[model samples]
Target: MSGSTHTVTNQPPPLVGYDVFAADRVLTEGLERHLDPGPLAETRAELTVLGRAAGSAQAREWGRLANVQPPGLRTHDPSGHRIDEVDFHPAWHRLVGKAVSAGLTAAWARPAGHLRRAAAFLVWSQVEAGHLCPVSMTHAAVPALRADPGLAALWEPRLTSTVYDFGLRPASQKAGVLLGTAMTEKQGGSDVHALTTRAEALAEDGTYTLTGHKWFCSAPMSDGFLVLAQADAGPTCFLVPRVHEDGRRNPFAIQRLKDTLGNRSNASGEVEFDGTWARRVGDEGRGVRTLAGTVAAARLDCVLGSAALMRQAVAQAVHHCTYREAFGARLVDQPLMRTVLADLAVESEAATVLALRLAAACDGAADGDERERAFLRLAVPAAKYWVTKRCTPLVAEALECLGGNGYVEESVLPRLLREAPLNSLWAGPGNVQALDVLRAVQREPGAFDAFLLEVGKARGADHRLDAAVRGLLGELGDLDAVEARARRLVERIALVLQGSLLVRYAPAEVADAFCAARLGGDGGAAFGTLPHTLGLAGIVERARPVE
Candidate 1:
């Protein structure tokens, strides 16, 4: 006992036993405002239970185990027969099962589904983000399958089921199913039109055989995949099942699982499709159109996931600062540290408000609202670009708040940092999302107008927001260098939209700080650079997670 010169002391106790959902004032209030009172009550109760589970020691262990023990690919049987399968850690399956049981994948089939699912996804992702790969793919596949009523009729029920069936088995044998996608070839990342994978008609009944390679196939062990292949007519979408109708494995060969920077718990693979049987999802030449809704849905999930990362990162930082003191006071109460935490809180809250607003738009769109549908056309890409872009920096700064401890694997901050860049890269990259924003503005003028209409609601509420909107409108009018300035233009669009949302619903202090620092440039270039005189204490307190 006397061997060491000093004993360990002054460290804060581990952060556990807190309700993630309740601690998140922004999410809870947003859910209350967006959902009907009755549904809000019930959904809040459900999320509270989930939040407790997510923050529990057991769940934390699951997250640690999942990442430490990544998925492994099993390419063949011992007897030399090809049996392509990706095996996951038991913890991954536990997380996925919890997510499925929470109705994260059945958003389209439930009441107030999008709002519920969005909140659930945000909460669950904070626990383990890798398992969300299949969860999001399964959720997004609904719209793509709906392009063909017969296919939708056959698979929709299974996709929406709450059961988690894990294995490479026939769809008929499972109570539910998960989905994945293989859209890009090696030559084309976001440019799906450049895909060279070809599909040949196998029968007059619209079945086909695909022969090509997919450069990136996420969740390789998924029950089915929505793939893109060049057909006689043009590039088309197809549903490729893992097991054929005759109960035999499809001719799908997994080349190897990718070694990704993050998301280690999920398996992403390069696959070769040799005579892989598939059925056309929509019209032969309407692949892009058929997948439009699916992509938009997945993009929304990206926003939600990023927001979750930011929230958790900030929460961890605040929690650490609250208990760890330095010099003469708690770190959280230190003036400069308070300013930084408050600034991060502002960013996190703004992201949460915008994400939930998008979820509300999804709900409204599903209810046959034309304006909501149009708003989504512009909002999805903008939110995806901005929210995901903010995550990396936010997490990095938050990790710094914990000093060296945050950089180590023992803390979740490192994982959050690794996961941050992924969302921006997923769905599409920054340039892709920016270009998509421009495309929507030019091709779907009505959608852009709908977006402006949504933002216009809070015009007179805040002068800073009003000025930002006016500037954005002026920028939109000039299309000469639009493509060259797409990212800048998209950033303004996203900021203005987020500013508008904050002004309308956020508490006065939070909204004012966001508009000043984000819109009016009242802050420095880095995090924690908010004005000294601002209500930094109040904002930081709001973001702090308590037991």
Candidate 2:
């Protein structure tokens, strides 16, 4: 409403049709109500950045392309999976354009870590989970690019001003570039070491010849790909152009499109690269580390996006509960229903904040050292592990609140339920994250210990939350003797509180406005629980004599 709306006349051939703006508006309004002015401003700023980068002509084109299908209704009936092909829209490319520009700019320009955190929150909060989760991984590249200012010049202009409407254009000066990496064969998935993709280096042309059959190429039909291959040295990232700037097809061919569950808005296909031309991303031998780092940031994005969809579901549930009747009373008036709603709100708040905290830590740090990387390495998996794990059950709970109405396509709950599955498994699985946490504790005892000490100090000030901290510590044992287990417990609790900090900052009027609710009641007690809880405890545990 702040800006004047412009009328656009589309001149493109038609595909599927839809009520495009309805769901978007529903989400927008709900978010406005739940979020505070600060986050709201942040979200608006992000929207502005996204809007500006994707020119109006491209925006309308995407809207028309996206409007062609009923994304909310598409599914594979036989296996109860949503057919993935139904999800690809030219409009999504435009969204990516905006995301890359805005996200990268925020990373580069924002001096305060809080602004970067807010940008990350806004980007993922707007996401409705699907196959897009993988495509969503593209945004992860922003933070790394920001960390290395030298890469900023290379990434900024292309990310902020260019739109890849047709896919990857190797020669285009656009800001958003889709890097494909779907090279998993039948036997190789999470185990990339078992991959069969080969990229033979040709020093004469400064290009490599790539040959491979890849499964799960998320954007199989588009622009460029970050092809992963095995060399004599090790696994590595190769930039392969799929389309030329003149719009000629690159050597990468689409073999078959994979039918998928949810996120039908993006493509997940089988691809073949026959002597595909490519350039190295980092070092030849450092590909696996680069790949893992890329994947780690992506895991954080999964958590953030899932949390957003969860919020959308919560909004729908809350709206329905307040208006719909059950036995002559509003569903929200039912005590049990209210309890379920309350718990969902609490969890959503927590997940969102932890995500922002991680973003802040990663973006704020000037040095891209092991310590900075450690925050995201640990936080991303934990987030992906927890948020998605919570989403399915949360959707189910919301569905129960809706009764039979929830199962209907006319209602968004069914779409949400169908879409929720992808996040839990994406980025990395839950067990992978748990192991990452174990590794992080073992790798950086000093920083990890420092982080824990902060949490402990915060907890010491709050008797209620301290009890929870103590319970975890007691279960894990003293930090000095049982450092690894103790670190895990402290870290998880700190993460929970970190998320609450965002909720506290955002407009939770019920908690923020009322003195009794904020100061004298449970909200008051909860508000005082997290600042340095882990920090203090970490110090105490470390200071104790080593047994």
Give me the displacement of residue 63 in model 2, in angstroms: 9.4
Local accuracy of candidate 2 as per-residue lDDT tens digits, 172-281: 54545544456467778767788788879888543678888787776664345566787667776666666555765567666566666666556677777788777666
lDDT digits (tens) for residues 1-547 of candidate 1: 5588888877877777778888888999999899888998899899999999988988988998999999998898999999988888899899999999899999999877998999999898989798899999999999999999999988998899999988877887888999999998899888888989999998568799999999999889999999999998899999999997678999999999999999888889999999999999999989999999999999999999999999999999999999898997999999999999999999999999999999999999999999999999999999999999999999999999999999988879999899999999888999999999999999999999998898999979999889988888898899887899999999999999999898889888999999999999898889988888888899999998884
Steric clashes per prediction: 1, 40
Distance from true position, residue 107, model 2, in Å? 3.9
Model 1, poorest ten-residue lDDT window?
A: 1-10
lDDT of 2: 0.53
| Model 1, C-alpha of 51: deviation from truth (Å) | 0.8
Per-candidate TM-score against the hidden true structure: 0.98, 0.71
Runs in model 2 with CA error above 4 Å?
1-127, 131-135, 142-156, 160-168, 173-176, 244-248, 366-374, 471-547
